[model samples]
Target chain A: MSSVNDIQNEIIEEFNILGDDKESTIFYIMELGGKLPDFPENERIDSNIIKGCQSKVWLTAKDDNDQIEFLADSNTDITKGLISLLIRVLSGKKPKEILDADLFFIDKIGMGNIIGSQRSNGLAAMIKQMKLYALAYQTKQNA
Target chain B: MSLNVDKIRDQFPVLHQEVNGRPLVYFDNAATTQKPQSVIDAISGYYKLDNSNIHRGAHTLADRATRYFEDTRAAVKEFINAREDSEIIFTKGTTESINLVASTYGRKFLTKGDEVLISAMEHHSNIVPWQMLCEEKEAVLKIIPVNDQGEIIYDEFEKLLSEKTKILSVIHVSNALGTINPVREMIQAAKKWGAKVFLDGAQSTSHLTIDVQELDCDFLAFSAHKLYGPTGLGILYGKREVLESMPPYQGGGEMIKEVSFEKTTYNDIPFKFEAGTPNIADVIAFKTALDFIREIGKSNIKNHEDELLRYASSSWSEIKGFIPVGIAKDKISVISFNIREMHPFDVGVMLDATGIAVRTGHHCTQPLMQRFGLEGTVRASFSVYNTKSEIDQMTEAVSKIAKIKNK
Candidate 1:
């Protein structure tokens, strides 16, 4: 299993080649989302939805021993790509590790310039939700 | 006379830039129109030379500021053909203007069991204020439903109107759908039932001619930014009698005639509604926007916009995945649509990459989107300065974007 930083570094390296061509970059993002595994339909309830997204995104997680595995889906392909990137880096990690993980890839890849202001806000919200899930599992473990 | 499109485009400095390494094709006029050089100059010029608090100033700067500010009010009176300058009340924008009426007029006048009639296509601004008013006053809020084409059902509107309706507040032209409502007839219909009429002209003031005395709406609200002026400035034109009847919107300096610890007497008509320091530079700059419109003339502006709409409407069918949302027969220059199987946000992002600025998402008319069974739509609104070439570029770009999903 790759560490969170290892995956983020891989993404940064992949994106650096596509550099400055927004059309190619956006299409690549969408292509990545196309390859994401289908999220469970039953788990796609309003309770699982993340707020602050212009497009609706459903995020659900299950604790596997000490590691948390996150499943996410979005109505928009670009938003799905964003959440999928998050899932790739943070999923299958211990709750404490996930909570402590630094998401430096978002800034390094210039996500703000690429997604515009609104989607950047949604990306921030999705990260917050993932960390909250991690915090919940951490509390359960402590208890 | 044909509008000098090139000359007009030259006047707007913002239109000359690139968004994402491509020349900008600004099709988001419904959100807010870009300001001209003259309007920009008017704003900075006010601050540079004539910045001072008006109405109670005892100095030279105040005198100049006061005169320029009132000149805008007078210019607005002429622009909308309101009876007098005193009838025009400056507020934050259309949202605040609507809120002012709801809070002051609706609070005092709206009673239990009375109906505050509005249309389903209203932006949240028009709908929320009435909803809040109804909740507090024990009044009922009635919505006039629109057809599949996004035109209001005239017969349904008539049925909704009754003796119970205290106010009939409706948008003159829908910002999302671009539907040009038959508000003149609706206003006339409401008048017979003794219901006050308020027209939200945020979209219409830029596209169509507004003559308040002719339309006979009790109140009309619109924003300056949408009319090629600055933000933070809007006009609320209430008939003198209607203005006199309503209580003050907020309490502070200019809105009062006399104030003591014991008692405070409010001012008259426009002053009673305008409280404290107003948006001075923006209001003054708005007059130049008004002048800009007058110099071109509304009819000429409409002619160019109509052509752009016609070209756009006819050309969209050739694209594989184009599905239009609002097909209203009487629309202004807006086209709201979706690409088949692709989300509006995705379409917007792709188009933005090509330097096309179109408003996506719900456009703040969530009920209208619900009515159409849509999450949201991609909206392209045009102005006089927009050319057919820009429309062509957007169409080609949208075609490329839509094909990515279709293929």
Candidate 2:
């Protein structure tokens, strides 16, 4: 299990290599998409689908013994990598932890500065979908 | 063409610049045309000489401002050959103008099971607004289908028009495809069903001669930026009776005659649609741009641009794997195409490296892209100032890019 500090280190290192420029960051994300883990057929469903995306994206979160985990895929290669980066920041936490987490980590990841308007918009849509999932999980747990 | 190409080119200061170690070849004219020196001077003169809020004030500056502001309305009325200046409403570009109608006019007149017809080749601005209106009104949104060449199938459109068709909002010229729509025929057919027709004139206003009375469209919308005027200003021309019938789009100053606590009486025709502080300087500057067009004459400009288009189409056709996207029998100067083995973005970037600027995207017509099964196209749209020499340069750049990508 990776600690929060460990994940933070991974993010920092990854961002350092990608640089802070928007064009470079998009290229980096596109490269990252080439290395993303594939999701199984059963994992691709409605809870994962993101609206307002030009590309089709599916993200699934698994709650295992109070820890949250996620896997995502997109038909668009660059968007797939973007989903992967999001999963890295958002996955592997409890529902409460995910709900409490600051998604502004995207700014720290340099995604806000590094992508084109459309790609950045797609990222925003993905982040919204992830946050919604966390909120739904919290509500279900509370209920 | 009798127009001096060199002299005309010199008038636009922005054109005399170097980008990436080469002279900038601006082909993004369909998206927005470059403003000439005269238009720029007119804009500056407005701010420096006559900077004041229009219509209401009695002060010296206000009187001058009001005169200049209202002068633009008169210019627009004459430009489109509308019956009166009262019919011309100034809004924030084509998108806002379209939305105003969908929200106000559509809400008032349309109901469940009614139809609003649009073409498949419309910009997302035209498509989304009506779709939203359809959702709210419980009306069905019908599409006038386009052929593979991006021309609307007139037979299909004729058959689609029915008594239930309340409105037919269509583009006069498709920004993405460059297809010059048969708007006169469309207006006649749609009118037979007692449907109001709105023409999206964003593309056509710059390229083609527009006479709203001649076309007989109930409403027409166009942007200043696309016509080589200032941005953030557009005209919405509606027939007096239709505009009077629709309620005011927003509640604000200038749009209302008297705002009491109990009830508010709206202002007449155009003012009822224009709310808040209008883009005064830009609106006034638009007169100079229109004057520039009038001086050149629309027919001469079209002929010059058509010559450039003919050169580009014939030259670019020679390149291997180069397929032009929109090939309607009647198209304006917009040439949208894709090269095999090259992504539209890659093609755009390559062209930029050679100082050629072309819009490489869905051109804000994603539904049109979806219809063609393409993500985007490399769009090289022309204007009055664009020369055949520039088209030759573009063709050369595209050919080189295609070869490099193919290799």
Candidate 3:
């Protein structure tokens, strides 16, 4: 399995190839979102809701054999794509690896340029929520 | 007479700029209009020349400032054709104006079992304050239903009206859908049942000719920013008898007559509601915006904006998977629609990339969205300065985005 940094670096390299073409980058991201696994309807409740988003987003996580797996969904295509990118980088990783991982690729690939200002705050909220889930799992593992 | 659209566009300096490497096409007029150069100049000119606190300062600048500030009230009174200048009260904006009525008029008039009737299409500002008032007074809050065509069902409203209905507050034109309500007819009907009528004219004042006497509405509230005027300024016009009856909304520096700690007499009608130092500079500058609109003539501006709305709506209907949200027969220059299976926010962002500014989300009218079974709609609203060419550009970009589904 690739390390978190290795996966982030791969994404950075992929997005870097797209260059300054905003439309193509947006379409590419949306296509990735379309490929995300179906999130369970039951889990899309208020408790799993991620705030600070213009569109509704739900995120859930569980520890599978000490590897954290995340499932997320958004009402908006771009937001869905954003979560899929995050999940692709951090899912199936150990709780400690997920918690310690840096998401510098977001700025490196200029994701802010594509997501716009308002949704950039939403992207930060998604990252914060995921890190919180990882921290919760890490605490449970110690016990 | 045909309007000179290019000349009008030249007066607004912000229209000349580019947003994202493309010339900006601002269709978010319902959210807030781009100020004309004259209005901007007037704002700065106030600070440069007549900068002083209004009313009480016994100085030369103060007198000039007071005259300019009160001049706006006179302009607004004439703009709306109110009965008297004293009937007009200045608040922070439409939201504050509505809150003042809800807290003061509602507190005094509404009692248990009294009903406050609002339409299905009210913005949150109109809905929330009444909800808060109803909750406090133990009064009943009722809604008049909106049809699929995005119009109020008159029969439903008639059925809902009763002696128990003490107040009827409705939007003159919907901010989200651009549905122009029959406020005059509704106000007349509500008055038959002895209910006070208030029109939320935040969206209408810029597009329509307003006559308070003709409508006979008990109160009317509107914001300046929506009318190409400066922000932080709004006008609330009330009937003389009604204004004199309601208790003071806020008590502070200006709103008091004589304060002896134990017995503090309140000031007269307009000054009684204007609690503290108002947005003096913005209020003074607002007269320039009103004058600008008058110079163009409201009817001429309306004709130009109506033409744009018709052109855009007809062109947009040709796109595949296009779903127009509000298809009211009578509307201002707003078009709210959604491309099938595309989130309104995504469409808005895609439009923004092409320097087309449209508004997305519930537009502060979540209940209206629920009525349409939608989370939100992409709204493109026009102003006097907007041209048909800009609408064509927007429609072309929207058409391209809609084709993304086929890919």
Candidate 4:
């Protein structure tokens, strides 16, 4: 399994190749949403939904063999793609590893330029939610 | 006579700009109209020349600033055809203006079992203020139901009015749907029960001609920002008699006539409501914005905006998966729609990528959205400065976005 840094670096290189055109970047991001595994319909409830998002996003997590896996979905395609990127970098890692993970690739690939200003809040909220799941798993592990 | 769209667009300096490698197509006029060059200059000019606290000032700049600020109230009084300049008061924005009435007028007049009626399509500001008032006064808040076409049911509104109805406040033109309420008739009906009428003219004063005398509304609130002026400055036009009946909204230097530890006397009508140091520069600049609208004339501006809305609705209706949120026959300055299988936020982002600005989300009209069985719609509002070419660009971009999801 690749380290978190190694995964972020790989993702950054791919996004760098996508160039700086906002339209293309957004279109590419929407296209990337297709990479996410199908989100469970049963888990898409108010409790699972993240607050402070313009678009509705439902996030869930599970601990498998002491490794935390994050699952997320959004009503909007671009937001879905954004969460998929988070999942790509941080999923299948131990709780401590996920919690301590620094998402430097967000700035490196100029994700802010791609997602626009309003979506930046949703992206931040999503990252916080992912880390919160990791913290929950880490707490469970300690118990 | 029709307006010279090119000339009008040229007057707004902000229109001549690029966004994301494309010429910015600003269609978010309902949120806040872009300031014209004259309005912008007026703001800077005030700071450069006459920057001083208004009213009760002995200095030269203070007197000039005071005169200019009062001149805006006079201009607004004429623009809305108010009975007197003293009837017009300046607040921060439409939200504050509404809150002022709710707090001042509603607090004094309302009592147990009394009703404050509002329509379903009102913005959150309009609704929340009254809701807070109703909750405090032990009054019942009534909503006039809206039809599927996003218009308030006239029959329902009439039925909602009763002797217990103390005030009937409603939006003149819906920011979310652009439906123009028959406020003139509504005001006439409201008077039968002796209910004061407040028109949330935040969207109307820009696109429509507002003659407060003709409409007979007791109060009208609108923001200067939506009228191509500055933000953080709003006008509250109240009938002189009605304004005098209400108590002071805030306790501050300007709003008070005399102060003491035991007894305090408040100023008259407009000043009674206007508290603290006002938004002097913006208020002065607002006259220029109103002048910009006056020079163009409402009829000419309406014709251009109606043409834009007509072209956009017809153009976008042809696209697959295009669903219009509001289809009120008497709508103006707004076209609300959504693409099938796509969230409004997504469509808004896609349009922004093409430098076409549109408003998404609930538009602060959550109840209205719920009434339509929608979370939100993409609202493309037009101003006098908007052109058909801009609408055409938006149409193409929307069609392209729709195709992506529908396919």
* Candidate 2 chain B minimal-lDDT segment of 10 residues: B341-350
Better of 1 and 2 by TM-score: 1
Give one digit per residue, the lDDT tens place, for model 4 in B1-407: 87778888888778899998899999999999898899999999999999999887799999999999989989999999998999999999999999998998899989999999999999999999999999998999999999999999999898888899999999999999999989989999999989999999999989888899999999999999999899999889898999999999989888888899999999987888888998999999999988888887889889988988888888889999999998998999799998999889888888889999999999999999999889899999988888888888988888888888787
Candidate 3's DockQ: 0.60
Residue B336, candidate 1: Cα error in Å is: 0.4
> Residue B9, candidate 4: how far off, in angstroms?
2.0
**For candidate 2, lDDT tens digit of each residue in B1-407?**
56787888888999999866678999999989999999999989988999999888979999989898899899999989999999999999999999999999999999999999999999999999999999988899999888899999999999999999999999999999899999999999899999999999999988888898989999999999998899999889999999999999998999899989999999987889887889999999999999989988889989989988898999999998898998999999989999985568656756776778899889999888999999899999998888888888888888876774455
Write down the C-alpha DockQ for each prediction: 0.80, 0.08, 0.60, 0.81
TM-score of 4: 0.97
- Each candidate: RMSD to true structure? 1.4, 5.6, 1.4, 1.4
**CA RMSD (A), model 1:** 1.4
Q: lDDT for each of the candidates?
A: 0.94, 0.85, 0.93, 0.90
TM (B chain), model 2: 0.98
Best by lDDT: 1
Interface-residue RMSD per candidate?
0.7, 6.1, 1.5, 0.8
Q: Compared with the true structure, what per-residue lDDT tens digits does model 1 show for residues B1-407?
A: 77889999999999999988889999999999999999999999999999999998899999999999999999999999999999999999999999999999999998899999999999999999999999999999999999999999999999999999899999999999999999999999999999999999999999998999999999999999999999988899999999999999888889899989999999987899999999999999999999999999999999999999999998987889899998999999999999999999999998999999999999899999999999999999999889999999998998899898776
Query: Which ten residues in a row are the worst by lDDT in model 1 chain B?
Result: B398-407
> Which stretches of candidate 3 lie above 4 Å from their native place?
none
